[model samples]
Target: MKLFRPATLVTLFTLAVSPARAWDYEGHRAVNQLALAALPTNFPAFVKTAEARERIAFLAGEPDRWRNITDDQALPHVNGPDHYLDLEQLEEFGLTPETVPALRYDFVAKLALARAQHPEKFTAIDPAKNKDHTRELVGFAPWAITEYCGKLRSEFSYLKAFQHYGGTADEIANAQQNILYTMGVMGHYVGDGSQPLHATKHHHGWVGENPHGYATNSSFHGWIDGGFFKKIGGVKVDAIVGKIRPAKIVGDPLKPEDLFRQMMAYFGDTEKLVAPLYQLEKEHKLTPENEHADEGKAFLETQLARGGQMLGDLWFSAWEQATEDRYLVTELKKRPAASAETK
Candidate 1:
């Protein structure tokens, strides 16, 4: 009988003990699993292993776990906004997703300037509830996804150099681990984007005007997130797995800006569904007993598929376009031969 490698054993052990939950945990895991299913055969072989696959799936909830740290106000302040992007709020700031600055800080500066120029358009936040100081700004989901893609690309670049040069097995394993962690955490944001509620101001029910008389229950967001799925006995991943096409490169693999634009476009596509989602709920279609519950289920399954497809494309693009990390290559070449052989 063959034995599992030490690294593989460690991974399995860690996953067994880690408590994970996001997108109601199961939804997030399904998104990561779906993305894995979408990967082509030529994508990295190590990531195809069962342990690595489970690690990625488990990580889909990592971002939400950070939300659990109540003692650290700074953590939630910085991380909370990344899970969403209120497209409607962008207009109030005199910006469109197309025109929003790609750099996070630049966008922050722009929002500050916008508020200074037009205070009347903004509502003052109540300091009592604004402990995180994030209430004034719209979310940053697109930028978060794009940044993760770049990080994954960098990981691939270094891993390639390490493998091609003289890096030891442990070094290669570590680099692959980095890639898996980044991919899994990033999946959280990508999965967040797939939910139409995360892309709009109507997030926690219809925020303002009641023209459509959509759901006003604050619990509505939680319901759509995973409650409905739980009521329906969870997502049917295998049923929709076949619907996901093979992963392909998105935008220009060499251009970060192109990827940014594509992320914005993806959000725009999801935003278009915001009204329809509310309408479905208003009609009780999302309820398990509703005659059209399947319609709601189909809508959600398609969104999950969308997240999986986009994530797979980003992963494929990162791998396909990762260039040699020349600096790392030069550094690796300087290491002693024995060091490379030890692991």
Candidate 2:
């Protein structure tokens, strides 16, 4: 038999020690995950989108503040974004904007668009959409299952803004829904943008009939969005927010989602931090409780800080950049044929 050399042994050692399990960090998932926390902060702004405020306040657990809206009104999400905001009538949700409501359900519309365009990718949604007639009071949805997947043909594509845009009502309809239908969907995508596993489907890579201990998607979601973030929560927020400086804008002058896109892109780094943790779990079977409760609390704090900071930057950047567009209304008005949202 050939003698095993030291380098070869080390190479095998590297692979062996490498955590066996991890999820692919697909772009869309990161956006969606970050949306959980983001949508709420963005709630105060956005005048035209009345329903957007309602959902934010609802998630923020101050539904009564939006007194006129009810859980039943929220259910129209099933009908689709346009129908929910356009046809339905909402009152208290819009009072603060101190302006005439313009059916601006960008958050709802964007999600509807995301779901319609790519059902497979957008299925990961806030767990709160379901729950058997009782909305569980929480800041965000639970991981694993959500209303995102169950819906049909609801995804939005921003293809129309492209010059070559063509196709039947179906084609144009889908594309327009993305930017037009919902802008805050930025929150959703920004959230997903941060998860390393969402960047890859290996999302919990093969471990031969056993998942690494201390990990579930909920665990992962919890890690980045929930717990891990708690660790350097104070610090991560500062870091990401700190990164928000004036950069030479690079994107389409007509419809520049570049800022938002870049925010999502930055999340690619989150995967780097999570990979090792998952690898450790796979090889050692580190139960979440063993590693999670106390010691992991620090992990949670740090990761969350990382995620929160990233999240904060994405939100602020998008809002700041979009607001910078002196022609937002003019640009929107230019799309005269484009329909307005309601409720």
Candidate 3:
């Protein structure tokens, strides 16, 4: 397989050393590793190899690495919104998770039309700060997750065709590599969804209302993302490993729309916990030495486990549902005669 080149590895390592925006690199790595643990023994043997495991774990930080490119406006414009979904902002557009479109561009179209019709409901964007032009969007975490799952299924289908038909070793290896890359990168978004802050407009802190008097500290997001864990000693990955259930198919794996609906439900569930997260912070339970520190730790650990379980389920479902690429198989069946005629 085409593993990452030496220079590319160096660059990724450098980027990973920087602070993470969602679950830190360590947390992301844990999610991928846990997912690997969740996979059934009958799944692809190549993926369970030691080298592949390390590759997937390292790649869990890949999407966040894309954010380091400040000079590339296009990169952020496309990649930024995939990491979150501000659920609270949806009501402003008269949309709910159930009502939102499954396709990315379709959702964008609907959001644009809504903004045009109700300009007052949205905040005015300053040209100076809105260079990426993504300020108008809420987020697309569910769509991103669903699309990646579909991509993984496609990879599995083609790999199956390559194996059953006449195909070179290099071709099979490359297909396997593609699957690994997609699985690893997709884990980043899954990890993002597990974080309650990523699901709400109060991601940084309570935004508009003050009925509960939650802390509006901008640092709250960063703290929950990584700092709190750092203070409590890194994510107890081993502690939660046993909690992961075996991977299972999510929705109808053959139907992308079904998977999309499942993702929305997942995000909707996460959004419900946003206020409780704020409540924990307000009670000083998140502090390292507080008497209630263990409670906060358990909450965060559960989120991590949830991400890992969901990721594993998606991967397993993709493998189970992958059908042979019939067109590729038909073409491959002709290859031997074509080569003989040339000879």
Number of the predicted model whose TM-score against the real structure is largest: 3
What digit string (tens of lDDT, one per residue) describes model 2 on residues 255-336? Answer: 4343323332343355454556566554432334454434443343344334434444433333333322223334544453
Off by over 4 Å in 1: 1-22, 336-343
Off by over 4 Å in 2: 1-54, 57-184, 207-261, 280-288, 291-295, 323-343
lDDT of each: 0.83, 0.31, 0.84
Segments of candidate 3 deviating more than 4 angstroms: 1-20, 254-256
Best candidate, lDDT: 3
Instruction: Give the per-residue lDDT of model 1 (tens digit) for 125-238.
Output: 568766777777788889999999989999999999999997789989999999999999999999988999888877766765788898766567777878899898887789
Summing lDDT over every window of 10 consecutive residues in candidate 1, give the lowest-scoring window.
1-10
Q: Comparing 1 and 3 by TM-score, which wins?
A: 3
lDDT of 3 by residue, 1-343 (tens): 1112122112221221112267878888989998998999899999999999999999999988888777889888888889988877788878888888889999888899998998987667667766887778788889999999889999999999999996899999999999999999999999999999888777665666579999776667778888899887798788999989999889795565899999999999999999999999888898988999888988998999999999999999989999998989999999999999999
Model 1 residue 225 CA deviation (Å) reads 0.6
lDDT score of residue 183 within candidate 3: 94
Clash pairs, candidate 3, are none
